[model samples]
Target chain A: MTSEAPTDLAIEVRGLVKRYRGGRGQDELSAVRGIDLGVRRGEVFGFLGPNGAGKTTTVRMLCTLLPITEGHATVAGVDVGRDPAEVRRRIGVALQEVGLDARQSGRELLELQCGLYRIADPAARSAELLRLVGLEDAADRLIGTYSGGMKRRLDLATALVHEPQVLFLDEPTTGLDPASRLTVWQEVRRINALGTTVFLTTQYLEEADQLCDRLAIIDDGTIVAQGTPDELKSELGSDVLTIGLDPVEHDRARDALLTLAGLDHVTDAAEGLAVYVDDAAGAVADVVRLLGDAGIRPGAIALSRPSLDDVFLASTGRRIEGGVPEMAS
Target chain B: MNETLLLARRAVREVWRIPAATIPALFIPVFFLVVNLGQVNRIFPPSTPFLHGQHYVAFQIPVSLVFAVSSATSGLAMVTDIDVGYLDKLLAAPIRRTAIVWGRLAADLARGIAVSMLVLAVGFAFGARVKSGLVGVLLLIALSAMWGVAYAGIAIAIALKTKNVQTTNASFIIFFPLLFLTPNFVPLDLLAGPLKAIARFNPVTYVITGLRDLVLFPDIHWGSLGACALTIALTGVALTALSLRALTRFSE
Candidate 1:
């Protein structure tokens, strides 16, 4: 169904495609095959995908770092292909690969970046950015000495220097620890709060579920599902009740759970049998009682609302974290 | 213009930040000039009318400067850019693509000029004279720096395409032939056999001949100077284009 045209739509893509010639005796592979999306301004839009799922490719195209092989895309009202330079002007990007000049101190590098963006009062801006990233204390230190998290923060700061309309972050927290990941999340929220549209790509489902207003789940170079976290979860019907039984009785447990009236889907996770049904509260008690009657003693049991993982499993019949072959035909 | 200047300034500032590396980059050519002159001058014939009766040290000073300039590769900087992802960042920026290429080229040219002038000053300490005077001195510096910048464009193109520092380093094989095939040591007229024929066609031979004419000869050789300038300008344009093409491919 079509929604109202967003007045603040900062990015729009219609059937965008990207293809790459595989190296060393391999055939050509299409990384992104006809993906359409729209990201509203001042909202954190996440593109969630596993590694090599064309997340970076899509972000690159939107940021004007890459050319579209086919189809059309626009960033902040500028066509990515026809006017990439202008798109670049209105957008800031922190790519998956951190791009800090090692020889330059944090202050010097930021100053140079400000100059490149033709920012007025570069020194003040650089100082402010350094402070924003919590690098003011070490601003004079060379970037080579900064830790990975520090580098990432500096990169984020660099992207914000130009006050861009759209900010694209490609898997920004891939290598960060939990605390640093949270810090990046906070900065991302802060950036969005400043009236900038944030387009982020991430592998962490929880991160997207927590931070993104809406997200597109991409797999094998295509958008398989798109909606808010709650909307996608709602599509899976109701809650999920996972019952873990002892002594490896998964087959019997699966068979027994599938016969329940309210249950819609039954699948096996490593730890237990996952039962999806219309009402978790109704189904969970029945599931345990049935398992007990069948002489199946559950060691541990959990009942909760359907998560993004369940939504992914419902659509693709595979765990979101499971390895899928790169560039699905 | 502001973007170009900013980029060029960053390149310069980066080089300055690492004194250990920058010092060696400047020192090697000056050291070679001192050590080679003492040993090579004994074999050279007496100075001719074209050489303006200058001593062997005076004659070789300009050649050494040219040699020094030509040897400064921009590949290391390109490799650094690749490692830090700055190259990709620049590609994604709104700045003119040509400005990125030209800015790097300009930085290389400026560095080469600075080093060559430093070597020339050292040579002057040893009694070398510029026969065409300050104007000739300026031309010599410009030509040496241009050659360096042109060759740097080639280096940058190779670095971008290969994306491997070792491979780019090994590609200096091309420069070996360019250096020795030219009349780097002796006058072009004094060369012999296939070497003389090759020197006639070598672009660097024209460059060195032009520098030698300005530094050692009494009169200006405008034709050689013009040819050298044109070759460097054209080569810079071609290699810069190739580098930019590689950058586009890389981003894709």
Candidate 2:
């Protein structure tokens, strides 16, 4: 758990590539083409992408769960392929799926996990983890009897019983109620606060923006953009003003918005035209007046500051499909 | 070794929680035992040399024990573990891989011994005797359980290779032929030439005969018994090699 190495990065990956060879006569599948990443020690570094974008594949390779097809990575200063056992010892991973033993109770699972790592005083360690996860009341009951949220908590607890130097959480809150999701976020923060490096992957931009200290926006199996949330938002350098127009008038609307003043540029969106402007307040009036002068009645119009979703749209040409509810900062 | 027991205990607990999973393996052999007992009672009287004055129920008891205890379903649980990603959790740990394999087999060994005792009890109630007495009974049970442990390797190998429930079940169904052709219905003396030749080589044959010798034969047939252990060891080594090889190639 000591960071004596010169480099403060807990993880360093370079040119990592993975390809799956399909069956005979079938084309090989490419999951991850190439990606490079650096995660600093004791920080929650989020990996965000839409589903099937190879986020899970990248995590698996880093955790030594899957063999890398090309390139390499080091986790906690150990080459993942060369010293996977050391990686296993240093990292605790909660996979995308909650793979708990349905027959075992919460306490039993913690005991098993601690035993797997040969941690001393498994009984005491399991008791502590159970209480930490707020599952003390249900610790003796079968995991199958627990609710979805309880299972998630137990999974997180199991992943942390070893006090790992680095923790990897894959979609930790994908199927939880808002309260449970918040609880997981708090747990992740608490883990990172204790000096454990956190590598989290999620499709939810809001989840990433809220929990991650810094993040990478991954699309199409590669990093499109990476920075702190504030820095990434500043990359847009302007607010997005969206004007919803009739599908029939979309072409004319695009042309009409181009002549407007105080607008940086226009990008046609799925529903309407998006105008980037230095000041949304000044641009909205011009937007309404310009459309009105053209005898066009807008379906709707809204202005919002840059969000990770906007950053995602800027990089990927479309908003993330996580259906995230973005709150104004 | 402690890790092995830890894994073994986990396996056993999973099986115990889903008690329904073991019902077919436990009771199907009882069906065979009961059905054979009624028919054989009418066909082979005590005077019949086929039983050699030993109770017909005694002659058929080993078959039922073998059939029941050696259901080859240990790998079915292994497939479920793989499918549900529980195996991944264990693999990510720093434990020895052989512990994972042997731990699963230990649970099957327990189930085999449990069922073997059940069949032996039923045979005793119906006048089947262990002429060589308690040690003979223990040997019979141990032999039956060892076969269970051995065939468990085959089931586990199939599970690891396919990682599909349907394929694992079909593989278990195919195991019937292995036992049926090995003199399960009649002793080798009554078997026809081709079946007798096959039985001469069928490892299950040695397993059953070894068990029956401990029960009905005048003295312990060390040749048959030693053959039983050797054959079990051979099948065990081959199937274990297959499973471990599959494990090494896993997620490659």
DockQ of each: 0.67, 0.65
The stretch of ten residues in a row with the least summed lDDT in candidate 2 chain A is A320-329
Candidate 1 reaches a DockQ of 0.67
Error of 1 at B27 (Å): 5.2
lDDT of 1 by residue, B124-238 (tens): 9877788888899898888888877877767777787788887776645677688778877677888898999998888778777777778776678888778878877887778
Candidate 2 has an fnat equal to: 0.54
Report the lDDT tens digits of candidate 2 across residue range B106-188: 89887878778888888889898998888898888888888888877877887888888787777567778878888776778
- Candidate 1 error regions (>4 Å): A1-8, A23-25, A322-329, B20-39, B45-52, B121-134, B248-252
DockQ of 2: 0.65
True contacts kept of each: 0.79, 0.54
Candidate that scores best on DockQ: 1
**Candidate 2 residue runs with Cα over 4 Å from true position:** A1-6, A268-271, A322-329
